[model samples]
Target: MTQLVGSLPPRWILRDPYAHQKGIPRFPRVVATVLAARGITTRPQAEAFYRPHLLPEYDPLLLPGMPEALRRVERAIEQRETIALFGDFDVDGVTSIAILHEGLAPLGAATIPYIPDRFSEGYGLNLGAIRTLADAGATLLITADCGISSVTEVAYANELGLDVIILDHHTVPEVLPPALAAINPKRIDSPYPFDELAACGVAYRFLQVLYEHLGRAFDDTAFIDLAALGTVVDVAPLIDENRRIVTRGLEAMRAGLRPGLQALARVSGVAPERFTAETLGFALGPRMNAAGRLAHANLALQLLLAPTAAAAATLAEQLNALNRERQRQTEEATALAEELLGPEDAPLLFVASEHISPGIVGLVASRLAERRNRPAVVLSRGPEESRASARSVPGFDIVVAIRKEKALLVRHGGHRSAAGFTVRNENLELLRDRLIATAAEQLGCQPAARVIEVDAQASLADLDGLEIKGLMAFEPTGHGNRKPVLLSRGVELREARPVGADRSHLRLTLRDGRVTWRGIAFRQAEADLDARVDIVYSLQRDLRGDGVELEVLDIAPAAAARPLEIRTG
Candidate 1:
């Protein structure tokens, strides 16, 4: 039997009973409990949570630097100054550039969208790219998704007589770059109620303010699609204003996908009517990001900016090929990284390799962090320098930890959960030691036991009336919002067999009373289980799309001699 996390079984934490109090609309006990778990106990809260259209619009000007950013943009437009849209080489950056270009171009602003090559320029605002944009007669440079920490690059731009405006959402450093306007909701002085907007969301908000300043109504339908794409791809929390953006954006997408996205959807084999947040996150986002991860991000930008369906189709096919290659490369790199990992139970998982692609180090780090339930750092080592990407488990602030050792780093910036830094090869080991010690003080030396938060406990028969429509009302579930998980106890495991290409998954037939449910547990083929089990799972549409199936999260022996303890909070 493969022990869960080597020794510790996953702790089951049941939802707090206080959230189940009255005031919420009458729903199935399971559904109501799930809503309460999410703090939607009020009628209005439920409405806004379920139907994002009901949420009130937040004022775009609430951001700290909004007024200054608006002024600079207005001045550039009035003077017909060419503005360069420099963005990061990811979905968030690509979509940010696309949104700004589409919004500003119609208002008589000459915008040139530029995404630096991931392989050559690395990340953020590079001096060479800044010099190139300046030489191209661009008097104004608007950096999307990045540039929050480019003090040196911004200074260079200023020397070339070009004003810079930053639209980003990364964690802000104590000393910000000297840009004309640094508009980011994460700024310490920001008054914005929600600070989790993706870079494209910030760009969209900027456009809203710009259009209002020009005495024109902002057409959200024109650009919300791109904003939503970036938000999901960047893993921004799906709450508050972000929820509204994705909800409306999804409606817009189903009504009509842009020519570029339409082509991508076709190539991805998803019908427009079937497009959901999952499609964006799982299908479209990966394909779009593949270009930046394995090749030049300009390919993705071209697909988004394709004027005709034919042009979009060609570009979409290329991105599809790139995505496949990216998957292969990531798999190979992850396997190599696992081999290099010193110990599975280390406080922090840090591995450096010349085999890992710098562009995919973040993805590799994310995988290791999830698998080990610890903070993970993956570095792509070059001759003299190494670029590292780190992913942290909940409760750990990776960027904050990395910031403490900035003396040895050339440049570093990112959010609490994810961060990246460039460091000299000689200091790599010392930096790793410092980070591991910091993580150990916080996370302990051993891997913490994984915990599964159960929204409700139910029998298989109780879910017979659970309509797929009602369950699916929880659309756009990711990051901050997650699909509800249910615990079904004392179920008979009638049949279990390995499935999938490598037989790495378990296909299960479970029964409680007279009701039977089919379930699939991924990567659990070797899990030794009792004939009867208590399973924690989420309900989802089966591959056939006609009925529901259990996507099991965890399982334990049924009716143990001593009933398994369930912790309630």
Candidate 2:
């Protein structure tokens, strides 16, 4: 690949053999090895991992603040109160609002789904929105994907005779908001077994409990797809409850997508049967987010809640246009960020410019962070204040680092790996300096190289039949859980050349003994391939209807590769 200056080469780490491999003897050797690597060593564990619906479903009532939130929702329905559903402009937030609105409307709740304008309101609950809702006869205000840190805003809502219920999954602050019920699994005293649900997941669970309390059977098949979309798009860890939700949701989607999603899939050129975590992250998620990034999130939300195919198709096309514009803007912003960064290496990358849009700062930060292998902060400088987004490397906690300088911030909240904040222009330079010093103290002069974990070492022949099928069991992989990588040594590279319109991808033909395979290495067009090389790859469906193909991740010249020590402890 075209290596960036100061970027460290990726370190390959092969996992040690699973200690309890013998417990899952029913699986093929390769399948068992890969399953064991993921901690599924027993038959029951394997069954549950492969068929997630077999896993135990935690009681929604166990979630912290569930009872209060549920009872308040019931009361609002009974009284026919106008409930204002406030959500963030992101996919998770929009999906959360859609779930609550669709679920509650059938029960006689007068719902007003509202997403703040990205330019005027930024993120979370704003005083102006609350006042507007109150004026429009909204007695109950429920926030999705936001409001956990909106202590002042919640108090203001309470003053306006509006009862606020916060449904959020972000990192909670030290002091709780004054909402009627602040529902989040991250609470210190939360009894909920899983703490990693996306905001949409939380909204889904609330509806489940609400339905049961009202003696109605909640249809998971109808709503799980939205939950899955939000979970994958928000980059929530795909384990435990999240795995089950996505597994079931994908099944439902394959069975048949809702009208809105059907139109969206048609526009995105994705078949429902081919739905995977990658589909949500790369296709649907970005398109949904593009509406908010370039225009208004309501456009995307309307598409999600569209009741007819005809209406949805037009909205989907509009969103597709917005997504294209968003992609162009992000590319321009990323290029500007690179230019501003120049040819230097720093413990942290910080760039601020009026040219960058507030909506695309997060995307810019994410791109720079991945390219430079360190934490990155990108800010769109407003006249008096700047909106900033921060993305971090695997081990670095970007939000925690930002929280240290909360005194300089107007508002900030997010997960460990990602965060956003608003800062007065006067404090921007000092905040950047302090953050750089903090990162330097922890990361030293240069950040460590990224590591790619390999599940097993297998020949090209070993990855066939049951082995390929077993690998398919790791579907819907993204973020925390990824497709397993296999290493094959000294494979003959028959051909290698740049592909794609932009020549950013490599098309390769390789052979191992009598078996031959075609591979594509994305964004690695500049990698110098050898005639005989060690290749690290994952199996993926061949889009051309040819069976399976290798998604090459990395390559090295023959036996020159010296991997890091295997972890045995």
Candidate 3:
């Protein structure tokens, strides 16, 4: 047994020896440690986190104006009013549109799904799109994933005599839009319990309320799968209400309900039984997003709703090809943007070029932000106005910074960490200066380096059957609920080598005494590290039938500081 160090909480080393003695239902030690660190102490809370349910505990009427919104939707459903779902072009927007269409189609309501082209019409509720929907005989207009800050566009829809219901999760403006019913958790006056729901989650709640009003019980299992996709892809917190939706959604995805989703799983080589958070984020989500990033996002939407396997296969293949093209473009653009920076360090980075595509500026900005550990903005020169995407570090609020310079922007809106805006080509320099000043003011005197939170320190001998089984309690980790990162010191390195064709990963053998483990670090082969190192990682079973292997996240030289004492039984 290892001894406990000073100031280290004794409970940190107290693993439930009988955790997995009962059956496979035993909670994994790593899972319990992570949950405990995040304030999830009770068994009931852990169970609720792992298996989310759309129970009667939550009431949609709690949302500001939800009752009125439901009343209007109920009226539209009863009268068979022509409803048009105006959605954004991203995955969340597409999934939200599909949810509303499928939920209302069986009620004899005629619904038209309209998604604006990212390159052509840009974002949000445009006056032209509204006019078109009204001309098509749409009496009720429903906006999803967008329209929270569209004060002007909503006024246009109201003037056209269109009854509008807005379901969105973006930040609310100072003055609310004058729509018939605006359903958003961000509303200052909203009484909704949870505020971290994604746009699709908001739409899902609206459907739930609609079902209740119609006195009908709708099976939402199939839709939950899509909800999971949008929620995870959109990077929503996997806790509280979102946890339930994602947990159930993953189950639905594994059961394989929709033809398109099943076909996507097959094409991506992701077995349903072997699915994990990585598969959704790295494999499935990117392919779906590819359609919107390069070409028409409607292709992905159509694929999701595809009724035939043959149709799904064709659409999936097309999306795959588009994804490949997107990768090539992204790589070229990122390399060029990096070259422009040289060695200059600013509070923020602003890169503009005629070669960059407006469709992928956001992705490029995100990558640059991660690499530089500072706020980054990537711009594509438009004919009249230049468009830019902004990504920020955790401590800085880029959206708020952009909003302070609202006088210089034609349009701008997004979350605190990520935002986008359009400005006149002549104002690019002014915008850059204003953004840097705003960041300096808001972020204080010095920018803070990123910090990694570790759950506990462990020796290789501590990773026994009991600890591994206890960690299994926390499944489906993402966003808000992250997997616990364990730091182990004095790890003797046996061998290390580059793996993968591109040499993007590192495979290493770490040992302490007779306990030896093989670990693989993804995308960290090029990182500077000595032969002997301290590693922070999450242990997972490979389960590939070739036996289990440990996966490492971060590795650095073992410092000469005081050693961590551990008490093990």
- Taking all chains together, each candidate's TM-score versus the true structure is 0.96, 0.97, 0.91
Off by over 4 Å in 2: 1-7, 17-23, 567-569
**Any residue pairs clashing in model 2, and if so which?**
1-527
lDDT of 2 by residue, 1-569 (tens): 33453355577887655533443676777777777777778888877778888877899888778899889889999988999999999999999999998999878899999999989989888999999999999999999999999999999999999999999999988999998999998888889999999999999999998999999978888799999999999999998899998888998999999998999999999889888888999999999999998899999899999999999999999999999999999999999999998865688999999999999999999999888888999999999999999999876788889989999999999999999999999998899999999999888765467677888877876676888888877887887678978888889999989989899998999998888999999888777577888888998878754478999988878757656447654
Whose lDDT is higher: candidate 1's or candidate 3's?
A: 1
In candidate 3, clashing pairs total: 12
lDDT of 2 at 260: 89
User: What are the lDDT figures for the candidates, one per model?
Assistant: 0.87, 0.89, 0.79
Local error of candidate 1 at 192, Å?
1.1
Candidate that beats the other on TM-score, 1 or 3, i.e. the better one: 1
lDDT, residue 95, model 2: 95
Q: Rank the candidates by TM-score, best first.
A: 2, 1, 3
What TM-score does structure 2 among the candidates reach?
A: 0.97
Tens-digit lDDT track for model 1 on 120-215? 888899999999998999999999999999999999999999999999999999999999899999998888889999999999999988999988
